[model samples]
Target: VEPYAALVLGPALLLALLGPRWWDRLLARRGKEHWDSYEALAADYLEALQGMPTLRATGAVGRVRERLERRSAALHRTTVAKLRVSLVDTGLTDLAVQGGTAAAVLVACSSAATGRTAATGTYLLLLLASECFRPVRDLSREWHAGYLGVSAADGITGLRTAEAAVPDRGTVAADWASAPEIRFEDVRFTHPGSGRPALDGVSFTAAAGRTTAVVGPSGAGKSTLLSLLLRQRDPDRGSLTVAGTATAAYTLASLRRGIAVVSQDTYLFHATIAENLRIARPAATDEQLRAAARTAGIDQEIARLPDGYATLVGERGATLSGGQRQRLALARALLADAPVLILDEATSAVDERGQARIVRELAAAGRGRTCVVVAHRLDAVRHADHIVVLDAGRVAATGDHTTLLAGGGVYASLVAAGRTAQEERAA
Candidate 1:
C-alpha cells in the first residue's frame, strides 16, 4: 500500500512542480509584452498632458485620443492572455491535488479489503495524504497571486537604478565668489541616441567681467555649450574649466550657485509672485525683491497687479504675459547675484523696443560679471565684447560682432537672415 501511494504522490508532485515552471515561462513573456505596451501608453499620455494646449489649438486632440484607445485595446489583449495562462495553471494544480487524493484513498481501501492494515491505519493514510498536498496547493495559489506584483516590483527597481545613476549632490569642493573665466577646450559632446555630436571639438574662451555672445542658427550647439559650462553635463572628450578649475571638480550646488540663467521659457512654480522671486534668494526681503524687479524693469507691472507681490503666477507662470514672465525670470537671476550671468534668448518674447530696453538692463546688471548671451537675434548681441558663431557644432568664427560681420562667414549669413525676419515682421 505504501509503495503504491509513493508512486502516485511522486508523479503528482512532479506534475505540480513542472506545470508552474512552464506557466511561469509563458507569464514572463506575456509580462514583458505587457510592460512594453504599458510604457508606450504612459509616454503617450504624458506627452498629451504636457502638450494639451498645442493639441487643442491644432484640433488634434481627437486623433491623439484615438491612438491612445488603440494602445489601450492592445494592452487589454495581452492582459487577457496572461489571465488565461493563470487559469490554466490553476487547473493543473487542482488536477494534481485531486489525483493524489484519489490515489491515496484507493490505497487505503485496498489495505482494509486485503486486511494488510487496520481501519485506523487507513484513516491515518488519508489524513497524511491531505497534509502532504496542502503546502503545494498554497504555494501554487500564492505564486499566481504574486505574478503581477513581481512584475511591478521589477519596474520600480529599474526606475530606482536609473535615478541612482544621477547624483543629486557632489563630493567636490568649490568657491562661488570668484568670477571664473569659462573655457571649453577641444570639447566634444553627443546627446543620447544621436549620431552627430552636439559640440564637436569646440574651443572658446569667455573672459571674466565681459560679455561673450553665442550666435548661431537652430541646432548649432549654442545651448549645448552653455549646458556644459553650467555642468549640467560633462563633455565626452574634453575639459571645461571655470576660473581655471575643472567644472566637474566643483559640487553641483557650488557650480550652479556661481552662475545665474534666464532663458526664453521661464519656469515659474504655482506660487505667489514673491515666492517665485524668493526661489533665487530664499531669505531676500520684500524691499530687496522690489529692487531686483526694478532692475529687471518689471517692478511697475508687478506693483499694478491686484495682489501685487502676493499674486499667484499659476502653472509655469502662465498667468503673466510672455514678456512679463521673461522679466520676472531676469529679476530672479539678478537677485541670485552669482558671479556669472547667462541670458539664453532672454529677450525672445519681447518686442524690438522691449528687447533694446532689456538689453540695457542686462548690460547694467552684468557689470563686472562674466556674461554669456546665447541668441539668434544678432542686433541684440551686436554690442557684445566677443561673439562666437557656431555652425554644425563647430565654431565657424569668433571675434567681436563687428569682426564676425566683416569676416563674411556663418555669422554674417545668420545676421542677414535675422535682419530679413525683423524687416518682414515690421511690414
Candidate 2:
C-alpha cells in the first residue's frame, strides 16, 4: 500500500509542478500570434489616419472610415476568440489537477479503511497530493497573466520592425571643418509612386561661400532639386559629391552638419522657445539666443511673451503668426551657423514689410556662407548672385534674374504674369 501510494502521488505531484511551464510556453506562442495580428491592423489604421486630410479633401473619408471600422470589428472578434480559448484552457487545466487529487484521496481513504494503510500514511498521502497540485494551479493563473505581457511585447516588436523598414540615412561625423563642397552631376529623381520625375539630369555646382537661387514655375522641380541637396532621397542615377567626396562616403549626420534649411513649412516642436533654439545649437548662450532672434526681426515679439525665451510654443508653433514662425525658423537656422543655408520660400508667408526686414537681415546673416533660395516671388530671388530658371524638370534658363528676364524666355513670361496679377489685385 505504501509503494502504491508513492507511485500515484509522486507522478501526480510531478505533473502538477511541470504542467505550468509547458502551459506558459503555449500561451506565449498563442499570445504572440494574436498580438502580431492586432499590431498589423493598428498600423494600417494609423497609416490611413495620416492621410486623412487628403482622403477628406478628395471626398473618400466615408470609404476610409468604413474600411477602418471593418478592421476594428475584426480585431474585436479576434480578441474575444483568444479570450474564450484562454478561459477554456485555464478551466480544463484546473479540472485536471483537481480530478487527479480527488482520485488520489479516494485511493488513500480506501487503503486506510481496509487496514492496508495506516492513518498517518493516509494523511501524508493527501498532503502530498495537495502540495503537488498547488503548483499546477499557480502556474495556470500565471500563464493567463503572461499572455497579456507577451502580447504587449509582440506588439512592440511589430512596431520596431515596421520602423526599421523606413529608409534612414547614415550618421554624419561631428567634424564640420572637413565638410565637402556640394555638387549635383547630372542627378535625377522621381518621388515615390509619382508618374513623372521631379528632377531630370539637373547639373549644378553650389560653390563654397556663394549664393544661388533656383527659380521655376509651380512644378518645375525647384523644391525637388533642393531636396536632393539635403540628401532627403538619393538620385536615381548620376553622382552627388560633397567637398570632393561622394555623398555615400560620409555619414548623413556628417553631411547635414554643414547645411541648414529654412523652408515654407517651418516645424517647431511643442516646447519652450529656448528648447527649440537649443535643438539647432545646444550650447548656444542666452545672449546668442537673443541675438539670433533680433537678427531674424522677432526679438520684440519673443520679449513680450510671459516667460520670454522660456515661453512654450504650442504644437507646430500654432500660437505664432506665419511671419513670426518663419522668423523663429530663421533664428533656429541662424543658431546652427552651418556653412550652407537653403531658404525655400522663407519670406513668402510674411507681409511685404516683414519680407523687407527678413530679406535685409538674411543678406547680412548670409555673408561668408553658401546660400540657396527657392522663391516664387521674383523680388526675393532678384538679389541672388546666380539664378537658374527651371521649366518641366529641366533648366530652361540660367543666369542672374536680370539676365534671364532680359533673355525673353520662361522667366520673362513668369515675371510678366506676376506683374499683371499684382496690378489686377491693386485695381
Candidate 3:
C-alpha cells in the first residue's frame, strides 16, 4: 500500500541477505586463527614456565625467550587481523543502513515535487523511513558487540556434546576389605596414530600386601604399563582388575582412591612443605606428616630448612635437590596411606645409601599394604618381594632378587649393565 516505504526496505533486505554470510565466513576464518594462535601461545607459555629452572641452569633462557616472543607475535598478528575484519564488517553494515535511509528520502522528495503528496504526508513517510531503519541499525551495532559470543558458541557446544573416551558407568564405589592386588590380564594399548602398541598383552600381578617391582629397558613400556594401572588410559584389549574386580566395573574415583603413584617426574606445586604433604591426606596430623617424611628419609633435610615444615618449595620444588624432591613425593604418597602405593623410578635421584634406607622403610611401612615400584636403579627393586622384568612390552622374567639373578636372562644382563655403570661413575 505504501510504495515509497519500499525504497527504505530494499537495502535492508539486501543487507539482511548478504551481511550474515559475509560475517560467517570472514569472522569465523579470522576467529579460528585467533584460537589457533592462542592455543600455541598457551602451550609455549606453560612449557617455558615449567622448565624455567632447567633453561636457566643450561644457560638457554634466551633461546626459550625467543621462541616465546615468536609465539606472542603470531598471537598479536591474529588479534590485529580479527579486529580489522570486525571493523570492516561493522562499517559496511552502517553504510547499508544509511543508504536505505537516503533512498527513502529521495523517493519521498520525488513524490512531493510531482504534486502527488502533501507536505504532511511526505514528512510522515520520512519519519517512518528512519524508524524502519532503527531496528536494523540496532541489530548491526549489537552484532559487532556480540560477535565474540557467536565465535565462542561452537567451542561451548563442542564441550557440552563431547563424550568421554572411557565412560564412567558405575553408581557404587568398589569396596576392598584389604590391600587389593593389581592384575593386568592380556592388556594391550596402542597410542593414537602409532602403529606400535605401547603395551602388548602385558600381564602381571601385584599381589596383595606385597611389593611388586616392575623393571624394564628404556622402551619396554614400563611407564605405559603404569599409566594403564592408573587409568590414565584404559587398555584397548584386556582387563585390569583390583582385588579380583575388573577396573572398568569400579568408579574411577573409587579405583584411584585405592592407589597412590610417585613417579620420577612427580610434581609439587609452589607451596609449603606441610601444605604439599597435606594434599595427599588433608586431615593428616602434623605428626603423621613428620612420620611419613621420616620414613621417606627426608625428615632431616626438611628439618634443616629455614622454615622447617612451613618452608615454601618453589615451582615444582625447584628449591630442593632432586633427591629431596623425590623423597618429599614419597612422603606425600605414604601420607595418602592408600591400599596400594606405586613408585615409578621415584627414588632414582636419591643417593644409593638413602635409596637403600627408603627401600627398607617402604618394606617395613608397607606391612599390611601393597607397593608397586618401577625403578631403573636395581637397588630400589632388588629386595622387592616380587619383580616383573619387562622387555618390548612383555614380561621377560618374573621372580624375586635371587631367582631372577639366577635366571641369567634379561634380568641378569640388566644387573650386570647397572653394576658396570656404577663402577664407571665410581672410577
Candidate 4:
C-alpha cells in the first residue's frame, strides 16, 4: 500500500517542483509586456489631450483621435495576451492536481482489491498524496499575485539610490554682507546626456554693487552662466568665484541665501499673496510685504483685488495675468533682500506698458546689489553699467550698451535684430 502511495505522489512531486518556474516565466513575460504597453498608451493619450486645443484650431482633431485609438488597441491586445497566459497557467494547475489525485486513487484501489492493503490504508494514502502538492499550489498562486509589486519596488529602489548619491556639501558660509563680485574664468559646462557643451571657456566678471547685463542669441549660454553662479551646477573645467573665494567653499544654503532670482517661468503656491511673499522672509511684517510689492510695481494691482493682499493665488498663479504673476515673483524676490539679484528675461511676458514700469522699478531697486540681467530686449539693458555679449558659448564682446553697439559686432547685430522684431510687432 505504501509503495502504491509513493507511486501516486511521485509525478505530483515532480510537477510541484517544476510548475512554479514555468508559471513564473509566463507571468513575468506577460507582466512586462503589459506594463510597457500601458505606459506607452498613457503617454500618448496625455500628449493628445494636452494638444487638443491646437488640434481643434488646425482642424486635425480627427487625425489625433485616430492615433490615440491605435495606441489603445495595442494596449488592449497586450492586456488580452496577459489574460490568456493566466488562463493557461490555471488550466495547467488544475490538470496536475486532478490527474495526480485520480491516479493515486486507482493505484490504491487495485492494491486493496488484491488484499495488499485495507480501506483505511487506502484513505490515508490519498490524504498524504494531496498534502504533498499543497505547498506547490500555494507558492504558484502567491508568486503570480506579487510579481507586479516586485517590479514596481525594484524601480523605486533604483530611483531613491540614484537621488541619494548627489553630494550635499553646504556646511561653510559664503560672504554676502559685502556685496561681492562674481567672476567666471574660462568656465566650461556640458549638460548630462548631451553631446555639445553649453558654455565653452566663458570668461567674464559681474562687478559688485552694479547691474551687469548679458545678451546673446538663443543658444549663447546666458542661462547656463546664471545657473553656474547659483551653484546649481559646477563648471567642467574652469572656476566660478564669488568675491575672491571659489563657490565650492561655501555651503549650498549659504550660497543660495545671497542670491535672489526672478525668471520667465514664475511659480506661485496656492495660497494668499501675503503667504507667498512670506516664503522669502518668513517673519516679515505686513508693512514690509506691502513695501516689497510697491518696489515690484504690483502694489496697486494687489490692493485693487477684492481680498487685497489676502487673495488666493490659484495653482501656479494661473488666476493672475502674466504681468501680475511676474510682478508677484519680483515682489517675492525683493522680500528676500539677497545681496545678488538675477533677472533672467524677467519682463519677457509683460506688455510694453508693464515692461516699462517693471524695468524702471528694477533699475531703481537694484542700486546696491550685484544684479545680473539676461535679456533679449536691448532697451531694458541700455543703461546697464556693463553688458557682455556671448556668441556660441564664448564672450564675443564686453562693454556698456553703447560701447557694444558702437563696436558693430555680435552685440550690434543682436540689437538690430531686436529692433526689427519690435518694429514688425508694432506695425
RMSD per model, one decimal: 4.5, 4.5, 3.9, 4.0
Q: What TM-score, computed on C-alpha atoms, does each candidate reach?
A: 0.78, 0.80, 0.83, 0.81
Kindly state the number of residue pairs that clash in model 4. 1
lDDT per residue (tens digit) for residues 137-250 in model 4: 787688667766764665677787775322466566875676789999999999899899999999889999999999999999999899888887888989999888888888
Deviation of model 1 at 90, angstroms: 3.5
Model 2: how far residue 85 lies from native, Å: 2.4
lDDT string, candidate 3, 1-427, tens digits = 2486695677675785467557668887788788778878998899888788899999999998898899999999999999898877877776777777788888889889987778998998889878876777777677666766766677788999998767788565766778988898899889889899988998889999999999988999999988887777889998988888887788889888888888898789899999999999999999999999999999988899899999999988879988989899999999999888888898889988888888889999998888898999998898889999999888888999999999899999999999999999999
lDDT of 1 at 37: 81
Strongest candidate by TM-score: 3
Candidate 2 matches the true fold with a TM-score of 0.80
lDDT of each: 0.86, 0.80, 0.86, 0.85
Q: Kindly provide the TM-score of model 3 when superposed on the true structure, using C-alpha atoms.
A: 0.83
Give the true-structure RMSD of model 1. 4.5
**Model 1, stretches more than 4 Å misplaced?**
1-21, 93-145, 153-155, 162-172, 190-197, 236-238
Model 4 pairs in collision: 170-251
